[model samples]
Target: MGIEFTALHWIYVVFIVLIIGFMVKRRDTTLICIVGIFMLAIGATGDFTSSISGVFNSFIYAITELLSTILIISIIVAMSRVMMTSGINEVMVAPFTKIIKTPALAYWTIGLLMMLISWFFWPSPAVALLGAVLLPVAIRAGLPALGVAMAMNLFGHGIALSSDFVIQGAPKLTADAAGIPVGDVVSASIPLVITMGVVTTIVAYIFLRRDMKRGTFLLNTVSEENEDSTQAMEENLLSIGQKRFFAVLIPIAFILDVMAMAVFKLQGGDATALIGGTSVFILLLLSIVAHKSEGLEKTTSYLIQGFQFGFKVFGPVIPIAAFFYLGDVGFIQIIGDHLPATSHGIVNDLGVGLAAVVPLTKEIAVVTLTVVGAITGLDGSGFSGISLAGSVGSLFGNAIGGGTATLTALGQITAIWIGGGTLIPWALIPAAAICNVSPFELARRNLIPVVIGLVVTTIVAMFLI
Candidate 1:
């Protein structure tokens, strides 16, 4: 039952470590990944020309696999831009300012509201919408910009995205890789996700409050710059009626979309498509309403801007993701069809090998899966690692008796929470940019709370499983 590590496998392991090392130093790993891909290709083909071709093909394959996610994000950003320009985004949060009267209320209110919005429209768009709207309110209500950033990051990216109960994209990714039903993963993840979310956000809020009391919570230079830009953007000329109409219209449209999703039982890609398509339509509608005579040009302009933002965010991620994809189920497609017939995926093989080598009791299985999930998340794309987590979960489950669903859910939660946005500076950019704080600062603030949350969630998962 012993598994031998092939040159490809060994190379994969080495590159993963190098990538983690680079990430730890807060360095860019895109170039390192491309080089790793070349070396991996060479190991597989032993032909310089073929290796070069394989590298290109691997990038192409990664893009193909990730196109849906990229497209949805782009479309949502486009929709948000349209809302912002129309002055609707401002109106969207006007109602909330009434309830968020103090810093404590502002923190929890913004965090909970962000969590809800992120569940439906996704965190990318939610950040854009809320940053333009709620962030200013939070700041005006005596919350520091960094505190605002932490709340938004933890709730939107950390909690909503990690659970992904509404879109079910994360669970689907894990389930598909494990060859299990998505419902099983989703059902099992709910408790763990809630535990992580509640604990992390509460702990982070307390830290924020402590900082405020100590007078260490003054706004940084970045916040002043962001505030000035925000004020400039807010100086828009719009009829009151137009703003009111859109503020109401946008929420109604999203509410209907959610209802439709429930009625249709749409999950995963279908659900994303529903939301993305609705966003496009809303963008078009708002553009036309805002610029009746020049709507055509305006719509195109908004779309062009959205695509630019989307591609800009995704550019560095593609290369890193391509390198990791090769170690998972996508290897045969990325490399060549002629990979050894006996070859299991690099990660899958490693998981099985570990299960064989280690004495895995229930506690050990939980700890191992949690560690593996966290390690896989180092890529800063919470998603790319889930397949590995799922595969490893299955292997471990088979080695033991059962609880594959619980283990898979635990791994999924840990991977998404760590890499989805909380701990990774690169991944925290969306929330950081919106809150106008340094991504590194936000990551640092989130580190303790998230780590504690993950540990508690994993421990709870042990009993649940």
Candidate 2:
């Protein structure tokens, strides 16, 4: 059951370490990522021409996989542009101004709200739908832009995405691989999810509060250079009544989409498509209504702005994403089938290898599952190598004679929390771009809280097991 390590795997691990190091130092990792992709390709193909092509192919593959997410972000930004330009955003957030009167209130409210919405639409779409409406309110209420990003990232991606109770997608994956009923995994995860969510959000809020008190966070979030575009109040094209109408209409439209998702069992890409399409329509409708004579050109102008912002946010992310793609199924497609016949992707192999080497003591079981889960999660999907967690959990379960569900659930939580979006830079672009913060900065902000939560949760799992 021991995994045979190849040059491809080693090269990937080395690059990952380098990338993490660079990110920690706040250095750019684009060149390192590109070099790593080339090294992985060379390791895989051993042919000069194909290896060179593989690097380019890896980028293409990464972009294609991310295209849907990018489109949704672009469309949402385009929609927000019209709302802002027409003065609709001010009206949209006006009601919340009274409720979230303080930074603490803003952080917790947005966190809880995002956690709730992410359950249905997933974090990417949830971010698109909510960030536009809530972010301005949060920032205006005294919380910085980075705090808003942390709240959304931790609550939406860390809490709701890890648990996935509504969709039950995460549980289903781990359950199948663990040879247990999905219900078992869900039931077992409830307490741990609650623990991690409450603990992490609280810790993150505390850190944010301290930073604000120490004047670490910039109170005026808008940069001086871009103040004219982002901060200045634009002349309202629509009348006050018109702004009020669209403000109400927009939320209602998104609400209906949520209902449609529940009615039709829409999730993931299908759900995202519905939201993206709705955003496009709203963007078009509002542009025509606001600009009247200049509507057509204005609509395209807003779209151009959205695309510009989206690509600028994503530009630094592509290289790192391209490099990690090799650790997953992207390896075969980008570089051809150079993996060992028994290999189940490099990331999963590493998890299996870890599980194979670790002795199956109950105490060690929880620890191994966490480590293995984290290892698998390095690829950033949180879903790609989770089956290995379940499979490994089952293997260790036989030794302990109980706690299979707990172990499996622990693996799922850790994997999703780390890889889902909370920690990974590229994986978290949705929230980062939406809140207009650096994904690496967001990841850094979440690291302490998430790691603490994970450690505490792991210890709690020891008791549960």
Candidate 3:
């Protein structure tokens, strides 16, 4: 039977076209998402009352599915903030500073720290903390602000966030769409994630070295006056004893958490729970250490600040994710009431329809999926587009033969690595803002290396998966 386009499907297509137009014009994604949702609701119900209700229901559903992960991320961010405000962030990176006296070492050190911290606390909080403390040191050690930003983007957002071994956000979405265990996605992603990280980091290092040789490297450092200002900021944020305690306690706690997670078979939600529970414990500890008598009030204050930071990091991406979520049959059925009960894979159906009209080979399919991933990543949130990729992956993979999950994972990685901010100007804003570099410049510097790494990773996945 020929696939017929319903009003709801047409509305989705139009919404996608508008969103793409908005992205090309460098307009706001959040605004586009809201408009897209409105269009989808109206198209599906064809009645104002039901359309309005559908919009509200979709919004609520989106938030409900995401709330647990968001809350966990927020709490971890709060812990990082407490660590930073308590001066633990400085102490955490101090050891690396001594070892990373050169630009090369500084780049790797910063990347490693970002990966480690992101694995535990997630990239959002990790970037904030790393930028606040480690960026200065790396820059002073002769690493360019652009280079530091690139490393953080690749390692934290691209690698750690993609694997999501600790929090499992990315894996959860992919697994749900594929009807596989989250643990399967997590396990399957690790080798791919590691390959991408190593290739990307090495390529980035080579580019940085080439730039250094050409004397195009920019030194990052504060003036003596600015150093004094920074010190003052530190003093106001942390007392001597509080600084000392956290300086000792926070790292030890994180190391223990890692060991425990590894020692135990904690996976999926359990892994995130472990990290969140630890973050709360650490938050309480820092509060007690920092505020003493007013610890309760102070801890609550820090948590509020952390939530604000988390929302700032994640809030803008949620609506975009909601729109993408509709692309999944599971979610499409919820949103598109008239969809057939037998229509198990809506994304596959759409891809198949397109495939029939447009000539597509295996290589073309792979490239198309990669490009789609990169496009989805334009909103600068990596996990947001994963469900779409997973859905598309299954469709194309089955058509091509076997290895649907593998291709889906590859597509997911590419989308996240590129649009997740490693090589896109607008997407890199958060990391650029934290590193005090021009986001455009960082994106430009990152493009070649990241692309090379992505190519290598895709090829590797084709064989491995």
Candidate 4:
């Protein structure tokens, strides 16, 4: 509590506000984040060249920290691309169409399936995995394209990604910033994620149904376009039998990996490694089987596609993440040992400092973190600012002397629910595009339900804390 608040701290705080402001204005935060790193470095070391080098160093540190996440997502995307192009994905999702006869059945089935697939591969790849194949089927059954987009967004990006039980990327980032165990964050998130997912999806469905009765949602299949795309993708490199074979084998292999994770009690990096490895194997197997004589070249091509997707997804996140890292262990590494002797990292010290000045309460902490998380998420990556949430949660937890994990989880839920594709038009692109719906319309449809869910989820998190 006696930690000195230095120019470094003030600089960090100012930039945090600037970062949030930039995000709110829908401007790029990359330049500000870089400027922030330099500012902090210069504030700490009082040298020009050192500040310059520190900016680059922070980038290296951020990229190094983020490399594993990038690799896993890339590998999964590559696997998904091959599945989608090879016709295996078509076969894989065919069974669902038979069960999706009614509108209600179609909505729930598609949502649940998307959630399940999202848990394993995460949402982007999950979209690539089966959304295209399932969209027309659900649409034919009377679920509007917007409704399908909602189900996929709420379940896949909202629920699966928020909990991130399999990938653990979300937990790892928050946990590291909060200085807590990944297990604590993951365990604490379960009830909150469930509450949010259930409430939001149900609310969204309710509104969707009400509108359906009025025939508000117009049905358009874009079937010809979809078929044309499919025909173009079909090089017929894979026989129907081979397509069917992979359609069966691919799920089985991933299922086994999931089983192995459970059997070994694997989490975080270990679990991510297992998933990434299996994806690589699947990608290789598919590329070889589908491309035969040119399999090697095809494999590389798929990897390139995957890497492109991965970097594109994460590229916006890196700079912001780098700037936030300095609030934790990254401080000493990037800017040298310049913090006050009593300082317990910038974020931790801020927590202590705040607690010392204010009469902190769980209620206030809950609302503050919820807002901070949502504000940070205005960037729409949902990921770029979770470290800030973790930092702030850690801060408040220190002030209150408990509930770090709960607060961190709450922040994660809020941020991801807001910007992870549910209410954000741009973030909704994958599901929207796949379902042939307007992303803005999808976002508008999601707003009420998501807000209701966030309110409910925050209350639940309050009780947990």
Which candidate tops TM-score? Answer: 4
Best by lDDT: 4
Which portions of model 3 miss their true places by more than 4 Å?
A: 1-14, 29-47, 135-146, 177-180, 218-229, 232-245, 259-264, 329-337, 351-361, 430-435
Per-candidate TM equals 0.84, 0.65, 0.86, 0.97
Q: Number of backbone collisions per candidate, in order? A: 0, 0, 1, 0
Cα lDDT for residue 392, candidate 1: 65
Regions more than 4 Å wrong, model 4: 221-223
Candidate 1 clash pair list: none
Q: For candidate 4, what is the TM-score?
A: 0.97
Superior by TM-score: candidate 2 or candidate 3: 3
| Per-model RMSD to reference | 3.7, 7.2, 3.3, 1.4
Would you list the clashing residue pairs of candidate 2?
A: none
- Clashing residue pairs, candidate 4? none
lDDT of each: 0.78, 0.77, 0.72, 0.87
* lDDT over C-alpha atoms for residue 168 of model 2: 62
Alpha carbon deviation, residue 199, candidate 3 (Å): 1.8
* Candidate 2 residue 397 C-alpha distance from true site, Å: 13
Summarize candidate 1's per-residue lDDT along 1-465 as a digit string, tens digits. Answer: 545678887887788677767755656677888899999989988899988988899889867865766777677778777777767777778888899889999999988888988886678778877875677777778998888888888999889988887666677667755657788888888888889888999888888889899998774424566656555443344577888887888788878988997898776678778888888888888778777888889889988988887677567667766786776666777777535566566766666666677777778888978987897677687875675577667767766667788888888888878888888898999888877778998899999999899889889988986
